[model samples]
Target: MADFNLSLFDTSPFFLTGIPGLESAHIWISIPFSMFYIISLLGNFTILFVVSKEQTLHKPMYMLLCMLALTDIGLPTSVVPKALCIFWFNLTSITVGGCLTQMFFLYIFSGMQSAILMAMAFDRYVAICNPLRYTTILTNARIAKLALVGLLRALLIVLPMPLLLSRHPFCANRIIPNTYCNHIGITKISCVDTTVNRMYALVAVLVFVGIDLTIIAGSYILIIRALFRISSKQTHQKALNTCTAHIFVMLMFYPPFVFSTLTYRFGQGIAPQIHIMLANFYFVAPPMLNPIIYGVKTKEIRDKVFKYSCRM
Candidate 1:
């Protein structure tokens, strides 16, 4: 229509203005970001390595942990390097195609992480609620299917984003006010109507992440109820103990996500700096903390980590 006639997007580069209000401190900011990246990479890798190599850890729970580790690694990898380039080297010009690519994988990994957490909740539910049927119910084939479905679900849901945005005519203003490219951040610069883009993103979050969180909540509620009915206090304590790591991880994962999403939509009172910082932390905290949470709260991972470390 008139929108397309007025503006057309060329294959030019999109400039990223790293952290809206923190440009003056980008060098200093890169220091902490670098440290987080290293810690997250190392920590998630260690978890993946320990889980894969340790024969004792070859169960449904540990398999799910490995999936979490992979997702943890994936999301950071998608954004951090480009962010570091922007922060440290002042290389902020990313092609439209490249920006969209990062946006796609960033969302995909994030969605998968949420799905993996839901699967982990299911793993715990079966383990605690139906102990005898755990193995029979969650066979290797089923676990594989769950993982595949999670990956595909994320891919399918996020697939329309870049394609939808690509058709839009972008104005001359290509500066994305964040550390890296994001769906809303990128789409906001377009001269054309991005109502579809915004609505789709909202629906995707509500349908995908919303449903995953609801399932996780329902599983935990059932878990708590089952724990309460157990006759033996020791047995109840043990069951609760097993879920502590996952609970810690879930706490670390969901809060920042929810807060960032709220800030993007309804938080007009919040400062741009704070909102941008929260978005950055949403990508950083989960990956960095998940392995540590598992290692500290779960004895087996702790012992295995140390066992491998001592030998090396």
Candidate 2:
């Protein structure tokens, strides 16, 4: 029996906890998660479809928005369905390869989202700070180039993570206490030292996400200065109003992200279920809210959505 157990350790699937301490209530928990997933899918897809079909929407801001929509779609889709399966169908076991695949997509989309948000902030910066040069600086070709660079950066950064993780043999324990596979969670179950994995994860967040947030803050500072310099109150109000949606979306994303990361690293006294729930929220809330915020706040998008719906 001991030998059999040893043999199984190397080949066994990792079991997901799916909100620990609330196993009995997984059915109830899945209801809200499912609803959020559906809303995110519909909202982001609508944005993509509308943006692609309308020629008037082909500008730097809208292009960046479409990139955002793509990340929103990819981010949740990479994890939510698997989580729903765990919650609803008891399909909690995932192979090592499958878990790594899930982690790769999850991190890649997250990285891309951060880069795109920074790009959007720059778009607003150019539009407000140097309105005359906005068109010349952010042409269609330039927007495409920006999108490509963001994708490549995310790909290069995240591609190494899964490769690094795959080298470690996960034999002793195969149970992950979260609904989805993440780098840290997987590393915790490994038999050997995972200092390299943990350090790389920390470096990636500190370098990539840290830099993105700093640039975004700087852009907003310049934007505010430019807004105050405007002589016309109406123009100032209009410009500020244009930025409200992006700010709100950023708020939805970064706060929960920071909380989740900090809690995971330092909040050892916190309840496992609470940490799990907040982490799930970090993955889901931004995608679900971004399109709705943009739709209601951006007049062109709101109008296009209304017209498209009316025709449908």
TM-score of each: 0.95, 0.95
lDDT of each: 0.87, 0.88
Candidate 1 segments whose C-alpha is farther than 4 A from its true place: 1-9
Error of 1 at 290 (Å): 0.5
Clashing pairs in 1: none
Report the C-alpha lDDT of model 2 over 1-312, residue by residue, as the tens digit: 333223223556888889999999999988888898899989999999999999999988998999999999999889899999999899999887788889999988988889988999999999899899999999989989988998899889888888877777775668899999988898888787899989988888887779999999999999999998999999999899988999998988888777887788889999999989888867777898999999999999999999999997
Per-residue CA lDDT of candidate 1, range 1-312, in tens? 443322225767889888877888999987877888899999999998998898888888888989999999999899999989988888999988888889999989989999999999999999999999999999877998999999899989999888788777787888888878888788789887888899999999888778999999999999998998899999998999899989888888888787788788789798888898778867877789899888998899999999999997
Regions of candidate 2 where Cα sits further than 4 Å from its true position? 1-10
**Alpha carbon lDDT of residue 296, candidate 1?**
90
Measured over all alpha carbons after superposition, the RMSD of each candidate to the real structure, in angstroms, is: 2.4, 3.7
